[model samples]
Target: MRKSQIRNPKHRTENCPLSPRLNYFRIFLTFARNSIVRDMTFRANFLIDCLSTITWSLMDLGFYIFVVFRQTSQIGRDTGWGEWEFYTFLATTKLINGLVQAFFMPNCEEVSELVRSGNFDFALLKPIDTQFLVSLRKIDWPALSHIGVGGILLSISLWHITQREIDPAQLTLLTGVAYIFYILCGVAILYSLMISLAATSIWLGRNESLYDFWFYITNFSRYPMEIYSGDVGTPLRWICTFIIPVLIVVNVPARILAQPLAAETPEARFLLFFTPAAAVACLAISRWVFYRALRSYRSASS
Candidate 1:
């Protein structure tokens, strides 16, 4: 090889075809590093954003503690969730939502703006998958504070459960592994929903209502799905659970850690096995939606 080729090895590697999965992972890491650097450049703003996220999370927790907890010990009547168990569930929600908000929300939210401005054309021209590039391009590091707070709350809740000997299954290695896996499943499901909603920007030209729609939909997932029982609520539960699958996003993993596995009803047991499959299906549907929307996109020049 010539001296010039040796000196510019990066050019060669860039041109060479590599494992698509590994290449995408590297691109994601690059995006993450760039986001961190960008955030750090505005240190004061970054700190304020982190503090704001933490405050909102604390306020949510306080509402449950003071008002909601005053009415009932568990989330719903006959739901088996005690005070600490409910806290465990809340913590799980925080962890899963935090991951989604940190890694995917910003990018997904920007899709509309990109589409409106016709900048999405540039993204489509990229060598990597447009969906992957657009979805993982931004990282909201401040939103990750929720995960830290969640970890702390989860530890405290688990410690109390162990001290009280409330849950017979307890937090074992298997449970821990299962908890983490399901958390990822929860994150995947939410990401799929958000990205699918965001992809509508391509057809709509501008989708300012995306956030509002997302908020209304995800509000259903925030609470325990079991609360959606009875004649009036049962139909809504079925729609959200089977049609949308948001109900299981947090409930499945949260139940694993918060409730005894042996005590789960047959229906709950079915959901436990169904959630991973739901996550996969959601992702596939989202991917299809994104590409289909892209097919309808019209360039600015055209």
Candidate 2:
């Protein structure tokens, strides 16, 4: 047997170049850089991915132009979310979705595979937070094409709104801030939902339905909540608004920018106030679920 040497606890800490948190931040930057470089190396695939996303966005716009504009003047009878107004809402939805897809989707989509392959054990052993590591380890730069499309759509909608409205002064700094704030809120809600679903892979062994589940839940947010208002849509409205809170994610931000909720129903007011709270609650619950799942996880060797 080799002679055992006594190790000084201070040695490692003193020799470290950065604090634990700072080092983790540096690692995250490295991961982002590496992902960008990797995507650049596959130039053809990256360009194709970008083109596909832009094409899909155009198709979605065409559907609204043909179907919605042809049939109805506005989505809701009472609320003033007309063509350009609804377009603003759609644009906001696109921006939020694009950011989530670019940053979180690829990583969350791989969580089940990592767990099934026993690679998650390596994540757990890292010095940083496992959730952060799993969520941001990969970035899909091409998926961010929607953000540009959304900005263009938003600018057009805003121009229409200014031209149509009697007083274009409604687009104040406060309104702009609120829109940006709630866009970030929407992203947090989506991340929470995705992480919660990814965590389920711990017990289920494989969660092949991650994307399916995500799409189903977020699909509810892509449209105006007003469409789901009548008796036929009441149950769905309540469930998506109160229970899941997905409807509030897009609606709150959209309303802030496209149409102010000054004269809206009492229920709408309640949801507007509750959105920020809902974001915090969802994030906390998802973090708890993720850690709980990790605690119960066993390596493949076991």
Model 2 C-alpha lDDT per residue in residues 126-187, reported as the tens digit of each score: 54567888999999999899999999999999898877746452687888887899889889
TM-scores, in order shown?
0.92, 0.91
Inter-residue clash pairs, candidate 1: none
- By TM-score, the best candidate is 1
Off by over 4 Å in 2: 1-17, 165-169, 261-266
Alpha-carbon lDDT, every model: 0.85, 0.86
**Model 2 — TM-score against the truth?**
0.91
> What tens digits encode model 1's per-residue C-alpha lDDT throughout 109-177?
999999988888788756666788889999999999999989999999888887784444467788888
> lDDT (0-100) at residue 282 of candidate 1?
97
